[model samples]
Target: MAGHSKWANIKRQKAVVDAKRGKTFTQLSRAIILAARNGVPDPSGNFQLRTAIEKAKAAGIPNDNIERAIAKGAGTFSGDNHSLEEIRYEGYGPCGVAILIEALTDNRNRTAADLRVAFSKNGGNLGETGCVSWMFDQKGVCIVQGVVDEDQLLEASLEGGAESYEMTEEETAEVVTEVANLEILNQTLKDKGFQVTDAELRWIPSNNVEVTDSDQARSLLKLIDTLESLDDVQNVTSNFDMSEQLLSVSVV
Candidate 1:
C-alpha cells in the first residue's frame, strides 16, 4: 500500500477541497440522517449516530439543525421524501490508482449523473461493480490522538482485543481490526482513558498504488478533487498516498 503518511496527506487535501465546494456539509448531514435512520436516533444506543453527530458538531452545525435532522431520519418529523441508501462506486484515477467512492445518497439518479460527470472530467472512468473493490478490505479503523502516548495507547488497544495498532507519532496511534472486534476495541481504548478521535469502519487497501512523478501525482489528485467536489460524494478512498509536492498543485 502507499504509505500511511501519503494517504493521510490525500485525506487532508480532500477535506479542504470538499469544504470549499460546500459539499461537506450536505454529505455530513446525509451521514447524520442515515445514521439516525438505521440506528436509533439517540447517539447513546447508536455508535454510528454518535460519530455522525460529533462530525457535524465539529463542522459547526447548530444544535437545532442536528436535532431536526435526527428527527427526520427517525421519521418522527420530516419534510422531504428522504430515504438513505449506501452507494459504492469504482473508478481508476491517474497512475491507475484504484479508487472507491462511498456515499449515503437520497437521490441515486442525480448522484450517479453528477459522479459520472466528475469521473469523465477528471480523467477517471467510473466502472461496473467489482472493478476495484477487490483491492481493498473492510476493516475498522480507530484513530487515537490529542492526548495519549503510543505506549499507553497500544497497551489500551491491545488489552481491548484490537487486532493491531499503528503508531503515527508519540501521541497518536491507529488501531485496526476485523469487523467483529471493532466495538470492543474502541471501547477498550476509550476505557483505558485514551481520547478516541475517530472510530469507524473503513476500507483499507490490501496494497497501494504508487505515483512517483509530480505530474502523475497531480493528475491523480485532480481526479480525487473533482470526485470529492460532488455534493453527494462522501468519502473517496484511493490506493495512492498523497505527497506534499503533489498537493502543491492547485486544482481548478
Candidate 2:
C-alpha cells in the first residue's frame, strides 16, 4: 500500500475508535443533506447521495436522522434557512506537503475565516483556489480486504471496468478506476459480496511528497488536525507520506 494511503487508513480507524459520536453524526448528516439537495433526493438516482448514505451507515448514523436530513433538503420538512456551497481550498503544509481541503458551507465568509485561522495557526497558509488543485487528479478509490481472492477480484473488477488493483499482505487492497465509472464498479463489487472498506471520489496526488524528519512530520499532522476540526470541512486530502513509526502514532 502507498505510505500515505496506509496512514489514511490508520486515521480512519482512529476516527471510528475515538471520535466524538455527535460530531461524526453531524458531519454525516450534512453530507447527506447537501448531496440530496444539490443532486437528487433519491439515493438510487444520485451517486453521491448513495455514497454519503453508505458512509453515514458505516459511522452508525441513525436512519431517522438520515431520512430527516434528506426531507429537509428535498423541502418536505422545515429547514433552518441555510444554503450550502461546496468549497475547495489548496495549500502547502509543513515541509511543503501539498494539501486540499473540501468544505460544505452555508456561509463562505465564516468558513473561510475559520479555515484561514486553522491553517495559519498550524504553521501552514491557505493558498489561492488553483494554487495546488492542479497537482491532484480526481479518481475513484476503493479499498478492500487484501485477502479476498485476487483472481476473482481482478476478473470482477476488470469486467466491471476498474482501471487497476494493487494489494499488500496486510489484508488491504487499493482499487483505482475512472471517476466516471465509480458508481457502476462499486455497485457491481458490492452486489458480488466483496467487502468494500470505502468507495468514493478522491483527489489523488499526481505525485507524492515524502516527509523524512520527525519535526516536519509533527507539523504536517498538526495541520491535518486543524483542517479536520472545521464543522464545514467534510474531508481533507494531502500528499504527505508517513513512515511505519508514524503510522503507530497518527490515526486520522
Misplaced by over 4 Å in model 2 are 249-252
Cα lDDT of model 1 overall?
0.76
Give a tens-digit lDDT track for model 1, residues 1-252: 244345564465466545463566687787888889888999999888998898888777788888888987898885667677889999887778888999777788898888888878766788889999999998888888764456776677778877787765556667898876887888887788888877877888888776777776766777776787777788888887654455556333
Which of the numbered candidates is closest to the native, going by highest lDDT?
A: 2
Error of 2 at 238 (Å): 0.7
- Measured against the true structure, the TM-scores of the candidates, in listed sequence, are 0.87, 0.92
Q: What is the C-alpha lDDT profile of model 2 across 1-252, one tens digit per residue?
A: 455676677667778775567767878898898878888799999988988898899888889989988986786777467777888988888878889999988899998899888888877888898998988999998877745588888887887799888774366777889998988888777777787777888888888888777767877787787788778888889987777777555433
After superposition of all CA atoms, the RMSD between model 2 and the true structure is 2.0
- The total number of steric clashes, by the backbone 3 Å criterion, in model 1 comes to 2
Cα TM-score of candidate 1: 0.87
